[model samples]
Target: MQIVSALSEISDRYDALFVDLWGCVHDGVRVIPGANEALRAFRAKGGKVILVTNSPRPRAGVERQMDAFGVARDAWDDIATSGDSARVAMYRGIVGQKVWHLGYAGEEDGGFFTPPNVLDDPLEIARVPLDVAEGVVCTGPPDPSAHPDVMRPELLLAKTRGLKLLCANPDIVVDRGDRREWCAGAIAKLYSEMGGESLYFGKPHPPIYDLARRRLAKLADVPDAAILAIGDGPLTDAAGAMGEDLDLLFISGGLGAEETGTPRLGDPDPEKLAAYLEATGVVPTFVIGSLR
Candidate 1:
């Protein structure tokens, strides 16, 4: 893997970029220092920027969040979210009709009940109680700060009933500015470990990547070889890129900041970065401390 100082080093190679949002572009609170500039520069040079995210929110919801975070509107051309993909699966009755909603009460989860418009004559899903639920739809835990294993009892009951969990976001955790919180993926991972079946539609999985390609196709006819994937999550973004056979620009400063020993103003320590990459089994084509 080659460690580059900026996106410009390799931006000329790809016609399109599949960029991850949370850790690459923004830290959940604000846009990264060079993210907006780099993306805008890419778009200005006639390159397409598709913000392929594992966010459980639909594109519109992501837009709103981006606006709240002060992210520029011109930074991205389009978005393909895990929420939309999982929403389609949910409406297709992948997890049955009567499902139990497992997420925070007031948070914006795109109403989890709302059906995607792409499907014709979609299934009518209801948020029934867990006792009567045929499946479970998890956006995340009711409490992000709480450990995912805390729901073991509830998951145990659902497992006994043979209920499959439809995981909207396949991210184990995400950083909201400075605070890191557990995500739906963690819960789904735990459920799967307990012998319960958990269905994922996000990164490291093909569903969301398929959705991203369709979204990109709506704008241009770019081939798989002409695309570049950028992100911070080794398991999600890196694994997903490798799975899709795309070149990856892994941001070491996101989840593996300490492990990579990336300083605030320079490239990561080469030895530490190599060790970290070896441990994670992620072979990124390019590595950057941040999107800059």
Candidate 2:
């Protein structure tokens, strides 16, 4: 549990790196300063880097977003996203099954599937017979204003019907440029709390890490022991790394709401960092202000 300044310190030790996208490499809108340089340096040293993200968009869509933000595809060896993973899971079972999607209407269609029934209105869909559907998938952002009392009737419907809830993204909340918004995982978590069953398909889950590792193995001759997971979020990236038994390099410049003065946990203070970690019980192997 030591602090480091840059990725170069551990570059030689790790043959591959699974880097988080949103808060670590870039904000929602723009790439972080020196992030590209750090990746280039890692590549120069013959290290493979994979962009691992919890974005609910498909791999191609995520790449398009990266391209739009000037993040070159050549910077990373591969890209794996929760949306892509979920799509794979969905199609692997129950072809042509009815799915009640509970996110943004069009967002889930990126690569997931065009189910027989695509219900944008949760209330309208709830009135229909739930026995007709195979399962429920949460892929879009929740609209709190859609209902005053309860914003998630879809979860209730899924629970009542004893249907499986597939959560595409495991991130509870993400920093969209400057605004923080609840993603599909938040709703999935809420449903799980209410005695609902959900299958998560993102970071903090072993499958996504396995996919990244498999892809990395093809690009680099590094052992699993020589791979590192670098990210800003403790819950997703750090926890995922620890679960996979990989090294961790934490970026603390993003994802903190309070401007406390610490610079390690994105808190402006050490006390804040300690408090946050104590509450979450997520401790990283190394910490730094930024990748630079």
Candidate 3:
């Protein structure tokens, strides 16, 4: 469906809103025009908004990024991220266990902060033996060129050691600035292809949504019907909302530009969108250029 009327139709029904960060609110560098206004309007109408993101960085880092883009923390009730989800997973108890971190050292430390034991060197983890190691937490995509190996030895080691792989971010890729780059999900996919088992903890998975809901519940009583999710990517935003039975508003100007066919500003062509949705089987409840 198209959005000709003010978003209040959906906004008024729901007491809280779960908004996606990257595409819907801003690109990696700047806020999308009208998005901030739309969020303000929603808040003025008494709706609580919780900004959710799949960024592998810590919540503080996410906040800094948002601030750089002009989206103040006051604009939203709370922010939920993949890093936060990972922290929750770690805290559930895996103490004194060695973990093989598959992402950059910066990201590993940021995403899985405060873990019982986090080892950046694959050799250190391997030497401990898989049986002694607690699990593998894949935080970001590995650089194949740098590693010079298509099939990472870490994956084989994990498989041989029978390690449990926990994917902190389930997004395969995301739009950053003007380019798309691989995420933790890409590494997780590679591991899975090599017959490794994994547990994903971000979008399109039920646990993240549950976490968002709990965060929203604190601000106001959120009804399933009134809540709406706006996002750029279908896999994480649209699919995740649909999985939770919430209405979704797709922003075509975000990630996977090929899927949206070089999105432009203003309203999208319905005919083109319908074809794309049909091909992907991920139809949104409504469509807009952006949240604005």
Model 2, span 157-215: residue lDDT tens? 67887888788888877777767777777777888887888898899898788778777
Please report the candidate that would top lDDT against the real structure. Answer: 1
Put the candidates in TM-score order, highest first. Answer: 1, 2, 3
Local accuracy by lDDT, each model: 0.91, 0.72, 0.71
Record all residue pairs in model 2 with backbone atoms less than 3 Å apart, i.e. clashing: 103-140, 260-268, 260-269, 261-268, 261-269, 262-267, 262-268, 262-269
Q: In model 3, which runs have C-alpha deviations exceeding 4 angstroms? A: 3-10, 94-96, 104-111, 115-132, 144-151, 256-258
lDDT of 3: 0.71
* Model 3, residue 91: C-alpha shift (Å): 2.6
Task: Rank candidates by lDDT, best first.
Answer: 1, 2, 3
TM-score, candidate number 2: 0.85
Could you tell me every candidate's TM-score relative to the true structure? 0.97, 0.85, 0.85
Index of the highest-TM-score prediction: 1
lDDT tens digits by residue: candidate 3, 1-292: 6653345555666667788898778877888777787788888877888888887666667887788898856668887877777756655633224666666544433434554232332132221444467788767766623321354776788788777787888887767667666778877777788888887878888878887888888777868887888776777888898899988877766663455553645565566666777877777887766566
Which residues of candidate 2, in runs, are more than 4 Å off? 94-96, 104-110, 114-131, 142-149, 257-268
Q: Point out where model 1 deviates above 4 Å.
A: 104-110
